[model samples]
Structure formats: structure tokens, C-alpha cells
Target: MLSEKSEQFLMSLRLELLKRGKKEDEIEEVVDELRDHLHEAEQRGENVDDVTGGSVNHYIKTISKEMAFDKRIIKMVIGALFAIVAFFLIPRMVSGQLDLSMYRIIFYGLLTFVLLPLELWVLIEMLKKYGNSKKGYIAPILVALGGFLIILAGEFLLREYDGESVIVMEASTIFWLGVILSVVFILVCLYFYQWFYIGVLVYLVLPDLFANTMTDAAPGSKEYINVSTAITLILTVLALVGALAFYARYKKNS
Candidate 1:
């Protein structure tokens, strides 16, 4: 029997190979071979990582390097980069607060270009390590939140050091931006036909939904506030549950 982690690694490998434009027959052959090797290693009570010779990232990099340059890989990577760039810039552009100064551009560029991918890689590793557990379901959300907080912290530090030149946007702008971003994310996930991306959509939608509800709620009314909070919490939980259920079903069927 193959271990759950080995299974997850193989699934990820399949996706990576598919992105690299491997033929279906070839992918199936590669995955079958890997599955057999992993199962044999498990039967021998050997570690999967030791048998594979490295981690999931290492496998991805090795395979990518071995393959010819793939247009699918390029398109997928570009799509992701566009999504990330649009996610941050759209709201600022709509709200008219996007500073184009060299220093400001450099600051945002560093966060977008460097730290964001680092954060994503860390989360991917965590997901690979905890795919069958609750942590796997929650790690995506945590990673998204962690990246947001890091950006905010970076902004705060920039303000403290250069108070006159910091970038700031209204809460309302962010709320609307979040709504737009949620749609973009959902579309990307649909295009990719992946169930787990729903978790990301749910996490992104929550704050904006809550903010919108709170804004519409009657001020100075404890009952209204309580109702708004309750609704937000309930909806958020339902989204998460739905996403997780779909992911579990997808995993089972796949």
C-alpha cells in the first residue's frame, strides 16, 4: 500500500507533468512507475523521501528541468502572475491611490516578486506534508492570511520609516477590491478544474462579505451587529465546509 503522503506527491507530480505538456500516455506510465516504487518502499518500511531521493519541490524542479520548455507551463505561470498582480493593483487603481514613484514601485515589487512566492512555497510544503489531515484543509487559508499580514507589516514599517511616502487605501476600496479578486480567483480555479482552490476563494471572500454586511448593518444597534456577525460567521463556515467536502470527494474519485 502506498502512504497518503506518497499518494499526494504523485498527484502533485501528475499536475506538474501535465502542466509541462507531457502526453497522457506518458504521464500515466510515469505515475504508474512511481506508484509501484513508492508502494514497494512502503512494504519494505522505507521512507518515501529517501526512496524518492528528495522532497516534492525537488521532484518538481528535476522534472521541469528534464522536460523541454513547455508553453503550457509558461501560460499557467503567466496566468498566475497576472492574477496576483491584478489582485493587488486593481483595487488601488480603482481607488486612485497607486503611487508610481520609483521607491514605492520598488517596495511593492519586492513584496510581490519575492516574498509572496516564498510564502506560497512554504504553504505548498506544508500542504504536501499534511494532505490527509485537517491542517491541509486549513493551511491554504493560513498561508493567504500570512501573506496579507506580511504586506500590512511591510506597509507599517515603511510608514514608520518614511511617513510621508507610504501607500494607503480606504477600507471601502479594499472591500470592493476583495470582491473583484474573489471573482478572479474563482474563475481561475474553474479554468484549472481544481477543487482545493475553492478554499482560497472562500478565504478571500470572507472579509469582504463581512465588511459589506457590517457596513450595511444599522449603527448603534447591538442586535444588528450581533446578527451581522452571526451571518458572516455562518456563511464563512459553510463556504469552508463546502470546499473541504468537495475536495474530499474529488480526492476519493481521483
Candidate 2:
């Protein structure tokens, strides 16, 4: 007879393996193999509940009581970089660059070269350390974007002023403000802060980021208005997967 624990474990493993591109036909055999392996370990007093519960954590805790601290530090550092890029690079993109011919090159370079790498690094680290952490990073993104909005607002207002526009000063202030915001937002997200707020924010931002598409203005035209549509779509899909995985893990753990 299959124990309830074994049944749940096999089901979850099947789902997870499917998510990772496994075929249905092979899942049962793989599951049986897994059962055999665990049965061997059971002889030594290990149990399915222990591995699913906190074997991973027990291993990490033994290695470093400070893994949590290290993870936090890494997140904060990435958030800081994002804040800097948002304030400076965004303005450079909107009004065009002062020193570079292609504002896009600099703008996207910051996003690609600096911000994106950091984002991925933080994401990977989050998965490694706490793959079960909060799925909704929306509030944090909104909070960061809000800081950018203020900068955009100030840039708008400042440009209209009778006094000469000081690019350096404007950039510096916005950058710092964004940094402060990222710090706060990241901390909250890590702590699993406000679910409704985060979900609402994600809903609002996702379409803008992912759903819109570049289109040929006229049929048969080769013009592509925005390829960002594709990129955003990918993010949207990944976000959905992350959300589902988080929910499943949350339910299982709880």
C-alpha cells in the first residue's frame, strides 16, 4: 500500500518534473526509482517528511548560521544597483544622452549590462537561498517605479523653470531617492509584505510590461513598433510560473 506521504511525494515530483520538461510515461518509473532510493535511506531512519520539510535547511544551517544574512545583503546590493540605473539611465533615455550618440545604447546597456544581470543574479540567489520566498515582487517594483515617477515629475518641472537645468544635480538626487526606495521595497518583499498591494501592483504593471505588442501599422508592412512586447510576454509567463510554484510550495509547507 502506498502511504499518503509517498502518494503526495510522487504527485508533486511528477508535476515538478513535468514542469521541467519530463514526459508522463517516464514519471512513474522515475517515481518508483525514487521510492526505492528513499526506502533504502528509510532503513537508516530517514523519512520522506524530513527531506521535504527541512533537510535542505538543516544542511544550510550547518554550513552557515548566517546564510540568511548573506542572502539579504545580496538582495540589497542588487536593489541599489537597480535604483541607480532607473534614475540616471531612464532620464538619459527620455531626453537623450549628453555624451553618447545613441541614447538607446546607454539606456539599454544599463538595463542589460548592469540592471538585468543584477536582477538575474538576485533572482538566482533568491531561488538558491529561499526558492520558497515571496512570489510577488510587484510592490517592490512599484515602489521603485514610484521613485522614478517623482524624478520624471521633477525633471518635467525643473526643465520649465526659469533657472538653467542642472543635469548632474537632477540625476544625482533622483538616483539616491530611488536607492532609498529600493532598499525599503526589497526589505518588505523579503519579509512577505502586503499580499494585496503586491498583487494589485503586479496586475497593473504586467500588461504594460508584457502584454503590449509591436505591430505593423499597415498590413503587409514590415514595421515592428515594439519588440519589447515579446520580452514582456516572457516575463509575464515566468512570473505566472513563479507565482504558481510559490503558491504550491506555500500550501505544501503550511
Candidate 3:
């Protein structure tokens, strides 16, 4: 059995390679080879630092440089983008119509395509460096919190700006579009065997739908607002817990 430190090193190495877009099969092959080597070294009473020459990050960089990028990762990236779009759209569709403003378009575009990916890259790099320690998580958590604040500020600013409508689809069109996108999202999740995202979709998209369709409260009433807020909070908590559990299982399996 590999030591915990050796296992963490291997997991981090795999994650870095994946982030770098290395071919999945090739990455698995290299990881298996290293696992065997590490197993042998551990049996001989050597540590992970000894195997990696005291610098796992440098070792990972060297390995990443030697690996070729996977073209298929582009498809995965596109699918991820689609999922994000669907995630945002479903709630609006459920609320009755799809009224998109120019400001909302520009803001969400920059956020989803640019800032989000940049934040993910930063988090991944941070994890590669300090994933094994409790203190290492602090910086990443703070960075994530900062990103959340930026998003909240942007959303607040967006609501205040009465920008021109880029497009406004009626209820019927929006409903059909939501259905199609939801189907596509489900298919993609099923194809990837990532059921956690399905849970996310349910928690995120279904809450508004349920509040609007099932509840008797008037839309602008305090009761309606309270109920919506409560449902959203409960679902958000469930989603967070589910995501953490899923990540834990994924890490353990990996």
C-alpha cells in the first residue's frame, strides 16, 4: 500500500495533468507506472519526497511538459459551457419568459467565459501546490469567496442598470427552449456519468419552477419572497452538501 503522502502526490499529479489537457489514457498509464514505482519504493522504506527528489511540483511540471495535449478536451470544454448556459437559462424559463438585456449578456459572458475559467485555473494551480495541507485550503477558499463577492456585486449592478433588451422570448418559446436545453444537459450528464450535475440541476432549476407553479402566493408578495428565499436556501444547502460528498467520493475513488 502506498503511504498517504504518496497517494496525495499521485492524485495532485493526475489533477495537474488533467488541467493541462493531457490525454486521459496516457495520464492513467503514467500514473499507474508511478504508482507501482512508488509502491516498490515505499516497500523499501522511501518516502514520496525521496521518489520525487524533494519537489513534487517540479516533478509534475516535468511530466506535464512531456505529455501531449488532448484535442478532445475542447469538446469537453464546449459541453461544460453548454451546461453553464443551461443552468442559467432554466431558472429564467421557469419564471415565465426569457428576457435578456444587453448588460446581462455582456456581464454573464465575461463571467462565464473569462472570469470563471480563470478562477478555476487559479484554484487548480493552488490545489496542486498546497492540496495536502489544511492551511493550503485557506488561500483557495478566500479566492473563491472573493470571486463570489465579485459575482454578487456584478449582479447587483446589473439589476440597477436598465439596459436594452437584446432578446425577449415569450413563455411558449422559452418553455420549449428550456425543455430542449434540459434534455441536452441531461444527456450530457448521463454521457459523462456525472450524476452530481443532475443533482445540481434539480436543486438549482427546480426550486424556482416549484415556487412559481406550485405555490399560491402572489409573485411580489412578502410571503412569496420568503418562500422563494427559503426554498432557494434549502436547495442551495443540499446542493453544497451533495457537491462536497460527491467530491469526497471522487477523491477517494481516484
User: lDDT winner among the candidates?
Assistant: 3
Q: What is the Å distance of residue 88 in model 1 from its true position?
A: 1.3
lDDT of 2 by residue, 153-233 (tens): 655654454253234344335435434544454466557554543443344333322312233232122332244344446
* Residue 134 of model 2, lDDT score: 58
lDDT of each model, Cα atoms only? 0.65, 0.46, 0.78
TM per candidate comes to: 0.51, 0.25, 0.74
Among these predicted structures, which one has the highest TM-score? Answer: 3
Task: Write the residue-wise lDDT of candidate 1 on 1-254 in tens digits.
Answer: 67777887887676556645765666777789888888888888886797666565576665555445445656666766666666555434433244445555676788777887688677766765677589888988999898889888877766666434355666556546656766776777788884555554454445435544555543235654565457667878897898799899999999
Instruction: Give the runs in model 1 whose Cα sits over 4 Å from its true position.
Output: 3-28, 37-69, 99-101, 125-145, 161-254
Off by over 4 Å in 3: 1-12, 35-68, 171-180, 215-219, 233-254
The ten-residue window of minimal lDDT in model 3 covers 211-220
What value does the lDDT take at residue 217 in candidate 2?
Answer: 39
lDDT of 2 at 218: 27
Q: Please give the lDDT score at residue 155 for candidate 1.
A: 77
Candidate 3 lDDT by residue in tens digits, 64-162: 767889999998788788777777778677655566887888878888899889988888777767777785668688778988999899988877884
